[model samples]
Target: MKAPRLHIPIHYLKGVGPRLAGDLEHLGIKTIDDLFAYYPYRYDEYELKDLAEVNDQEQTTIVGKIQSEPLLHYYGKKKSRLTVRILSGKYLIQVVLFNRPFLKRTLTLGSVVTVTGKWDRNRAMLTASEIHAGEPDPGSKWSPVYTACSGISVRKLRALVKQAFIQYPDCIKENLPAAFIERYRLTGKREAVRTIHFPEDQEQLRQARRRLVYEEFLLYELKLHAYKQLKRVSQNGVQMNIDRPAVQKFIEALPFALTAAQERVVNEILSDMGAAFSMNRLLQGDVGSGKTIVAAIALYAAAVSGYQGALMVPTEILAEQHADQLDGLFAPYGITTGLLTGSVRGKRRGTLLRGLAEGKINVLVGTHALIQPEVIFRKLGLVVTDEQHRFGVRQRGALRLKGKEPDILYMTATPIPRTLALSVFGDMDVSTIDQLPGGRKKIKTYWVQEKIIDRVIHFMRNELEQGRQAYVICPLIEESEQLDVQNAIDVYTHLSQALPEFKVALMHGRLTPEEKEAAMDAFKKKEVQVLVSTTVVEVGVNVPNASLMIIYDADRFGLSQLHQLRGRVGRGNVQSYCILLADAKSETSKEKMRLMAETTDGFKLSGYDLKLRGPGDFFGSKQSGLPNFRLADMIHDYRTLTVARDDASRLVKSHEFWHADCYAPLRETLAESGLTQTVHLD
Candidate 1:
């Protein structure tokens, strides 16, 4: 049988054999479609310019004839340079090339060539970045620059692409409707695919890129909208009875009043819970915002409705913190609260598991242990996950699976930008607690050098002496030979000696669950006046008495993280302060420090952080949980993303679009887009 057109294996291409195909596979190009989808990361523009018109340090392309022999010089080990003098018009430009001694054999004397790079006009020098043997063509000014690896040159890949297009010119068909394309002024799918690799002009290239980006965003948004519709139409939720009187009574008995923001979020959550559809809401709040109290109301609603409520936190310490607060808050209302962490084992674990199975546990709070197989719930109606990003999708899904169809609520203290929130958590309804509790003061922040650290420590000691606790945060758990930053172990040792009169303890990820609990418990009880720890304590370790926080290598962290670390203090009204100890070398790091010292708004900081670090680095260690789009950027192309989302919303609103014959191509492309696999619509 003849080879397929669009789905043909890459090895079957005109020039790419099995060996070359293996190299292409490493770049995720295994078939004809994959090869086409692998778009260039950037483009290089080479425009023929007069030597007199080019300025120093400006990039320009010049055509010249080699007037001298190319000299090859070897400098550093495994490094060589090729130098040649080329006569262009009245200017004899000296061209320098690095690590390409083989070019000396190809560049013959008196041969006409085109060179592109930064111009050193004063010295009549052109540091050649790209050199072509023939004179440059003004018509073909733009060259596609693809990411390449060893054994697979970009030139070879470009040649293969050109051959593939020529061989299968009609392989790609239109997946988008003609009307949608005309309305958006998007180029045809096949035209865009061809022009993206070999554009005739800049305007055509721009249109091609825009067309591809729009399609990527539109398909992703369609999946998100489809997921929302599926949840609403297919999944039946538990219709919970709203015990308004009991809820109000519980709220009235609280020691502190809830902010308006908290009340509004609570109302939004409760309305979702009481609806016919299951609730899938994300609760976003800044640090120190009363998110816990809002979650408490939802949990209480579940409990009073005669259903069990489960709250999962990231760390065991956070679990204990929630369990303690919930126990005190629920004890008076005749509701039983239980904690199940990795450390809670043997008979206690069995008793807790038995309580959960028998419906005796009204509210359960724990870490990953809550997802254990034996931890069955009699009626798990509502599930709340704190720091939801910390757990993988499977972990959260496993807990949700424990219930028949539980209302899901995900809470995060890290504030996400609205654009990102829409894309990443598109399937969930979002509620943001924008206001902090009344009477909460902003944490006074300071960026100090290492030389002034002694003064900062003295101030910390003064605060400790005044009966307030403090925290010393280090970036590393232990000493690192590669890094010159302070570690928790060394910081603890230094603090223990520097402040000999005060009690100090160490907390890090290496500590056992039991040990971490003990250290946190001691800090809670004021048994330890100073706690030197790593980022393991970055999340939710509420201590109202801890009025000071000192972070070492603070610049090493992203703005969101530094804000989270700063939030560890300022829990009470004792006038908290956070001193960032960092010798920030780069201007970017210095700007981060200045921004931190300038503002306490977590949302503001997070927005700046997203813009500064981009979406991938914003979440730090964890994947941004965003679909990988070849041409669309969540941050840079936010406006296009918004338009695509609106269009998708309109499209998904009509049921016919899901099964109409005209939409079959879209559905097929969507299946291959990989967005549906990332999002669960069923």
Candidate 2:
């Protein structure tokens, strides 16, 4: 019997050892399958060209024979340069190689070599970036350039890949079915893998890439659909009785009316909850779009049915904020509300936990503490997580497991682009709140240069004199030598000195929880007239009286983030303003400022942000559950993604596909990949 070649440890390969395997692991390669599946980010062409046809400063490749002895020179410690003369056709071109003295041993007289680099025709020189000994086959000239790190080189990666192709010629088995392959006109899995690492021509490279990209996307969509399928079949959904009278009374008693969009989404959520299946929904809305009220209505419905509800946030301050807001909303209705956080200790924590277990707390709001094992729910029917991306899949699953298949509703103030929504939130239904509340004025936004600091300060002072609070946001908490931008501390000091009459406070992530709460609470009240902070105040910090927002180094932030910071103001009926102080010199930076000044639509800005920064950086950093595609770009390959999604959805819904013999390959691949192993199928 042949051993499982695909699963063999990478170090067992001909040239790779334990140390080299560890380095390869950084590039997400650990086994023989992983090594074969590794694809290049780009390819470099080394097609031999006629020396006479190449122009100055052009990237040209030439094959020649050495005519002179290689001259080696050492200029400094640990630095050496090698220069040689090579004759190609009728031209004698000079080749310069820097810091590579060992190459002198290989470049003997009359030895043929191939060099590719910029050709300085006027100087009769070719500055070589790549050099090889006697390289030329008819159709194999394009070289793959793998992304490298500290311990690995592109050459070594190429060599290892070559060794794999030669030794394990028939190791990789096909993952896609023959019918599907024929329908899509895709290359076979083994051939595609080999071609991706070393393609004979451009057309073959394109075909290989398309095959792998489609496969990746199909598998990804299949995994997501499988999760959705489990939820659909669980049969643990709660049928809650929405308290129409109590919900109406609460809404009528509110100071403002709900926007049409919010009402539509509320009905959608209520409809999902009343169904036989559980509700896995994502509520998308801009800042101050009244998502809390919609969530409050759902919680109220759950409470009326004698089932408990929990609201989890990313920060303690936001938790407390939600608790306070919900307390006021639930007070008159006689529904109990409680807060549990990391700071709640001993007797308080014990009391909260007991209240949760005894069903005394109808709705509990807290941070990560809400997911801890100590807290138990009597009958959890609804789980709402605010700023959903801040928590990972496991965190959300942990909260869901606190109950028996509780309905989940994720709330985000950040508007997710449609492409991301299809992939990241593919398993959940989405509801978007596009309209802001009535009586809210569009915040006046301005883009000013650093030279007009005095004028901007004078304008802010006027707003301060009118008893309105202001927030000054910087990108960093402390000065960074690498980035020349304003820090929170420096801004706080400067503001304190400039406006001595007003109370100024500083807040950042480095501060303790207690200290951060104190600063935020002071600013929330009218006690602190000016708040200086970093992006810590971006989410869940709402102050109606604070009408002025000045973000320093606005160019450093993504458009969506800048919109969120701008949202900190404009909560009240008063005329608010967002002053973007950035020396935006580049066209892209200037366009960002212009767009911020032109419109206040969060969705529009988010779409642009997704385009400007790819999916990986769109969330500022890689969110835990976001898919890592090797060759498929969420933006560029959207058509392929859509087709894959459609195919996956169709197949997942078909019962025959799950049990048929033809799909055994797909089933085996899905099982062995372990992508859905952690899904909460139970």
Candidate 3:
């Protein structure tokens, strides 16, 4: 079947014009195809009802005749109001409009008009900004609302959407197979597209959403699988047949023994590193679960085998922490370590670069500075990245090219669920460290209401009296001019004055780099008894002496982020405690906070976090490059995604599309869909 052609200009299509087309460009829409694909974030229906059926606080569309002429009244300097009276029976209903004096001229006595708005019972009035002269048809019950700007109305945008759908092609290309659609009980692509914008009823809208969600997940999984196959066939890895003696020596030198899970993961990584093909592996673990120790072992092994190793972290503080920790770990084996970051400059950086190029620096740890052009390695055999999600695919590729397809080990403290990992990272081998080292204490947690603020402060004071440090975390750095929320600066000032005997330091994202480094240095040296800041210290600021963490407005943060913040403490042998303070407004927020108070398991918290917040905020919106889908609800559409993934896998395996005649259109779709850039498919 031939596809239909669609052509429509911006000006002639309903309410849009040259001016509005520029506004639409902000949303990435330029043509009829783009307009049809712009889905609604949500839907709300106004049930049509008679004047007598309109109840208080219910949104309804009522048709009635004006019993009296509309009156205009001016209040203060620039305020004006319009009032109209409508009679259904003996009862006269008043409709009020504020700041719209022009509405009085539009309504005349005995004129029939349809009004849509909420009715208020206390004032016994119908307040509406939407009033039309003629009664709308009762059969046109469902109203399609679109997002609007200042000059554009929802009704106007809806008209434009209708015209675009009419101009859409007659036979849209089917991206999924017919059998797959039957198995999932999904609607056809062409029909779904039309119904999504102008659905006949609620049922049709639901079906359209299901079909689109399935298509999205199916295409995503297909591209991921194809990339995995290509990588496996193209790359080669170094074969190192060294025994496990180096790894064992490093483990024995540690003050504590490794957990069984950690030991198993270490062995798995070693096996991959010794293979003929290069290793593209991910080491995922919960926060403070001892994944870094395993990574250190792998680095030591590479160094002892006369090869260089590099560990790249996301932040300067994390890079420094890793350099310090590894320096102590490899001291006994006579292995030297060096640090690289934006802070290092002049002769020091040059000396570090010389050591690295001359093979004297066996192990190097730093941030993205390691990927700079001036930095060269003698024979880099292994590259390990901390918090791999923080870096982009292109950045990682650039780092990988520094050596001969060096074995890549990516680490992330964010505990992604097993099912999601299988779909998102299908191209990489996964190793999990699910255990903590011996002698480490689990941090105790508690959820307190705002009413107990005084008591929480009293506890913090007692901890400070014992010569211990604490952290006071706020959600915002500065008080927003519009919102009345607690900020870091205000909290810091109040704490400093309240506890004059103890020193307090403040830090936030708005601070200069030098100021931030100074604050961190002071906290590390024990010069500050209390550190007030944002989540900037979540990932890699290790101060074992600080034993208390009090998060203000904890309900505003996600579970994974809260877990990462709590991980800042509990690094040493001392027992730590965390306090979560919420305003007790939402039951959902209370339940999420209670879950955090019950356990210290990062993976369990992460799973529950996904169920509560979904995938959008799991790794944060910036880290995870998945575009926000309007029709696909990750929580409600999990089953559809599962079915779609299975169907796509089966079709790819059974059909000879890669080498057959019916594959040309599929190839074109893949290129035009932007999957080529997303999954890096050629």
Candidate 4:
């Protein structure tokens, strides 16, 4: 079937020229589909009411003739004000405006103007927020306030959207099954799109959004199921039989018993690996939730089947840490573990690579170096990735191709919100380790202004004196040429001067890799008492002795980002504290920081972060292989997500929709939505 002309350039649409097209592109509306999909973030009710009808503290618009010319006045040297009086029948409306001296010339006596603002009955005045010379633009009772650029007016966007709706009502054909839409009580696509932009009432808008959100989620969920199926097609790897005696011996040697959550997730991974299909699962746990141990158990299970396993991390430090750990865990059990990273010397790296290719290495851990063509594996049956988001989707695909469809395990410290996990990781089965291990301490967090930096430093000193380390994270690595934000170098210098007794060091992206490793190694070995750094340390720093996270300009970070920084501390049981010495300028930033101080749950923080920044900036949809919803908010429409997921799962698995010609259109729709990159079959 031919696709509709929805992809046509939006400039060709009636009343939109090249100038308006450029403005529309800023709003990501290059095509008719883009314009229609660009829904309003908010709405304004421009209900015009009589001066006598408006109640105090109500915002409304009024049309009246100015009875007098604007009276201009100066309030001190810093303020200029313009005041005007309008007559509506016998009711005289006093309008006061500020910082609008140009309005003095615009407000002519006996001129008709529309004023919108709040009425203060006690003061007998109307504080005008906007004064229009003519009738309200679009002249509708309800007006949409789109997320627009400075050059594109909402009135212009509304007009353009209305024209597209009229010209292309048939563009969004009734491809959706009638029975399906009826079952969900969803309005038709054409009707829903019309109502979304210009609703008759709040009820209509709600109905329209419900339909749009559900359809988006349903198609997205279907694609996820397809992707999972596509990846597991060659799941012909050896079934990793569970050797209980060896596993028991390994667990007995651990310093601590696995938490119930960790044990349960290990069982899940084991079950997946033992199945005919290759195990594709996500091991989601909060920072310090012991996901590494769970993954270790899975690796042991894979090795028990006489096949090799590879664990990949984002940084060389994390790779080395995992190798150091796995060596200790797997060595006594007669499982040979190896490390292959960029920094490994010639002879040692050569031996490790040869051992891996010869199947002598039972488990190998490294960074992107693991995916290099030369780092061949003999029988790679399992692939484990720590900090999964640190690597791109293509990187994961590359690693998987090294083996004959190896069982994959992804480990993430980022606790994805339940809604997001269902949508984003729908292709992979998710096993969450929700509980911290026994004796884990909850990190006490504090939100304070930068004025209290002295007190925070004193606390840091007290911790350091007890043989603990602290981290000071600045928002920037160097003083930006434009912005006045704090940087790592200046923070290190300032901290060194103020706390002269401690060994303070600095690190940033600008430093060579070796220098960065040296600085981090020094901190890890307690050679540096305080480390001043940027977000570089945000990902894989796992120092247990670091008990204090002193973040400068903490308000400059998003909730999840601040939470991740806080996760750097609290890794040890040393009564860790996260002191946010932030100078929050707005109430929104203050609220965000307060939420950070209130809870350590990354899932909750993720929800708040999504709401604050939307899905586009939440994470890279392209790199992460997750869809960026144009309409549906995964958090707000969580129920819809679940419903759609279940329905999509059922449809994808059922005989009729699974292989029937009737489902072709839906598959095509999914392909058009860009799911084909990850979810479509060959």
Candidate 5:
């Protein structure tokens, strides 16, 4: 029978049986395409050197015929040695291998051997580090080393790949357009893949790798540019005549003046809203940098323009918190506000939903409940979603569908650098509130060992004695099946017992809505001196009385989460402290803790975290709305990304470029990527 295509399952191949295919699947080599895509992690180089050319104390690999069987000698119980000699170019080279006596059978006389080791000048010997009983290929200077599994060896994998290339050369055909490749001076896809697998030298490998990396960036940039183009078109949106004088008056009435960055972003949002098309923008700010205030300004403009506005947050606690703050922030301008959440239902929900539909509630603040099928806006002109990474693109789209493409503003507290933010979310116009409000207290952070648990508690007790509250955050709400981390309930119970003089309480995900609210309410009211909880409190929890936050196993959380948790404290003018207690004692954990203690700048921490955890992990959960790129490294390959972005822009704007036949493959690739669904506001 004819051989199956490269896309066929690996078991159909010559040597990969069902058992072997299962083993190969673990290395992400399920199909022939996957096997070809599996690039080597590193390379081993060997130079065929003669004994006469080899230096006395230099590391080298030499291939020659063995003169005799390896002689074995033992010293004491564990020490053993095997001495062998090889003849190369009429010169004799002494080789000594320690502890591996099994080589006596493989290194027998008349057998060709390859030995690599450091030469010992005094003994005129080359102490063997690795010995192969075969003549090394003279033409090849390097050997590819792939990531392997338990059941697979390097030899078997190399042979399988060689067989694949030889048998199915058609499978590695170049698919990119010829003209484009020539213009960019890029190698063909076929040549690139071949050179990547087995390059003649470093220069060849470099050229091949460059082509693949650039292609990865180009594809990603195309998707991003397409999303941007599709989203920028004019839509039948709610056209607003923003009252500039009234808006300026409202800003002046606020207790604190708006920062320069905040004023500029507000103007940008207002300009977009007044345009005929819908406004799709992202408001990125650091923790406590006053992003909500900027969002409120946009909502106020919409409300005063005789249209409804809605702000969606991530958690109920944050929803309630924003509603309370917005109620006060906008109340002076006679702009009414309402709250809608999962907790508000039945007649209350019915009445709230009715008020929203009738325009009685000018601005509605809530969690995801704002997008429920039952909820309706009378004349929705603005929609703002906070902590945008926590929600999926589909969920945000559902919210937008509630109105006629109302102006959308997605807010995130994670402080990504400007370049990366633009590259990742190229579909949306970015506005950053880089400056925090003036006179904010700088939070002091410290890393403490687990052995000083009592001392840490005593310090917190002192803060509590002075009429301040504290937060004790655990990594888990309850015992986890996989991890041995501290749980909130256990920590709460221990704290309550250890400090009977002060009221302590536990809050976690398992608690009912009312129970959770009650615990948070008590803590907010200072009825509970210490609040023990998981990351539930990371979303914009405003408790100024809480001055101390002690996170147990802080290494378990992401850098942004840790920053948000630290933001919980230092809200007021009082000095705040964040103590991280890590017990894992590993280098990774120590580095994480040290980074937390060293800097309070979220942007710097984010870059550092991205460097440590790769773009896939750093972008956050799948719900974060970041595309899964298989090759692009946003941190390291930024220059390539910039070039590709420009290339995509140039192509998209050029009518002649799109009309070419070479654009066929680009169009096909884009169709399969689902770029519209991945990044859309309507």
Candidate 6:
């Protein structure tokens, strides 16, 4: 069926004008299609009760007779109130409106009206902002409640929404195939859209929600599968027949031995590089899991073959750190290393570019500046991205385009659950370094209440006296005087005054890039004994000397974030510790904190975190660009998502349906959803 065309201007719609159209635009609604797809955050139901059966304090709607006109009373100094007496059979209930004296003109005595609002039993008053005259219609149940601004009430939005639906076009096209819908037990698109706004009953609402949620997850999975297929078919990478003897010599010369897990993953990466196709792989490891060594080994192999390797980091601090560390490691093998960042300028940058283009720099480490047009490589063979989440698809592609489609290796410390990883990075093969390096000690964790903050500070001071550095993290930068949680600035001030003898540095999201770098450098060099910061330090910057990490209001952060913060202190083997300060009264908060205290394993913690808080907290829907499903619970809906993945994979593999005309609408829908734009499938 052809979709109906409905393109009426907002002003032409019933009960809407220029002023209201502008308000609707603020909510991202500009067209009829937009209004139809704008789902409600939640719904409020008013139970119907007879006037005689109405009791004070019970939230119910009742039909009653207004015995007296609402009288407007001014109660001194900009205070006003409206009161009306209503007769409900033998009982008389007083209706009160606060700060709304205009209701007196709208409501009159001797009119039968139905009122719905909160009932205050102790005061014998029914406070209502929504009161309609005449008897309530039995069919007028399950009112559609919409999100509204300060001036726009739910009733007003509801009326506009109802008009939109009534004027909605017929024959809305179904994007999914008939066979797919039947197998998944999903409602048709037209019916789902109609029922979601004006459901016949609760069951219809549930079915509509299920259909839409399934469609979203299905489309997302399909896009991921398509990207994976395209990458496998199109890209032809150089097979690196790397010298294994060189790799073995470097490993033997190392101060430490490689773990079995690390060795296995490195071998797998090497095997992929040796294959005809280009390697697009992810190296996932927990904090302190020695991933950098594996990466360095890969770059070393590439360098030994007279090819250049590029390591791109998200931050200048991380790039500098990588360059410094790699410079030390590669110097023994007579390999030249160069650093490139936004801060590197003039002669230094020009010389580095010249060295790279001349094949003098064997290993290059930098931030996104490495992908700049001016930076050229003589024989770029491998591209390694650190903390892959910070770089988007375009940035990664730009780096690959720099040299002959270099084998891409993306590294992430954020241990994603297997299910979520499939959806987020399904295009790449994943290798997890589950084992930590030998001799790395687990950081002891403690959850303390705010009352014992003074004692905690004393302990931190003692640690500082022993030549140890500490990290104090806050959720926000400046103090929101209204909010009770500690901010970085406020904590910095308090810590400075409390520990007047020690040096303190403050860093937050609001700081300038140079200022943040300076603050981080001071803390890294031990110039600052304590560094107060936000989650900006969650990744990249590594200070092995910082042995203490104290997170204020630990309950405010997600489980994965708390784990990432704790990972910062345990980098060095100096018996590090993490202290989570939280409110003791909240049992839920205590439970989440206990999860952090029990284990130091990030992969296990990620799974438990997903189960405890649900997958919604894993990537933070806003940050991950993943759809937020209304009906599908990440924890409970994993089975459905997996099923959808399997079905999508099968459909794509079997070309029988790929060329079918039935899929044209589905393809068009995918294009409209912006999924196609993100995944540039060839």
Q: Pick by lDDT: which candidate is best?
A: 1
**Per-residue alpha-carbon lDDT of candidate 5 for residues 1-682, written as tens digits (9 for 90 to 100):** 1122337677866888888999999988887778878888776668777666767788888777888777999998988999988886676878999987877777779888887788776676888777787877666767777878888877678778888888766676464678768888998898888888888899999889888888888877787777666666534667799998988998998999999989989999999899777888989988888999999999999988998999999888888999999999888778889998889978988888888888889999998888889898999999999988888878888999999989999999887876568777757778888888999889999998878989999999999999999999999887888987888988998898888999998888889878989999999999999999988888888999999999998888878788889999999989999999887567877888889999999888887888878777877565444655555577887777778777887776666544566666675567666642322222
Clashing residue pairs in candidate 4 are none
Residue-level lDDT tens digits of model 2 in 335-380: 8999999999999889889989999999999998998988999999
Off by over 4 Å in 1: 1-25, 30-36, 51-57, 68-80, 101-104, 120-125, 150-152, 160-195, 199-207, 236-239, 242-245, 275-278, 659-665, 671-682
- lDDT, each prediction: 0.87, 0.86, 0.79, 0.82, 0.83, 0.81
Ranked candidates (lDDT, high to low): 1, 2, 5, 4, 6, 3
Collision pairs in model 1 = none
Error of 3 at 86 (Å): 3.8
> Which wins on TM-score, candidate 3 or candidate 6?
3
lDDT of 4 by residue, 172-240 (tens): 555567778889899988898888888778898999999999988888888787666665664565576
What tens digits encode model 6's per-residue C-alpha lDDT throughout 20-75? Answer: 88888887778776777777766545456665465666666767899997888899
Candidate that would win on TM-score:
1
Candidate 4's TM-score reads 0.79
lDDT of 6: 0.81
Count: clashes, candidate 5: 0
Selected candidate, larger lDDT, 2 vs 3: 2
RMSD of every candidate to native, in Å, equals 3.9, 4.4, 5.1, 5.8, 7.0, 5.5
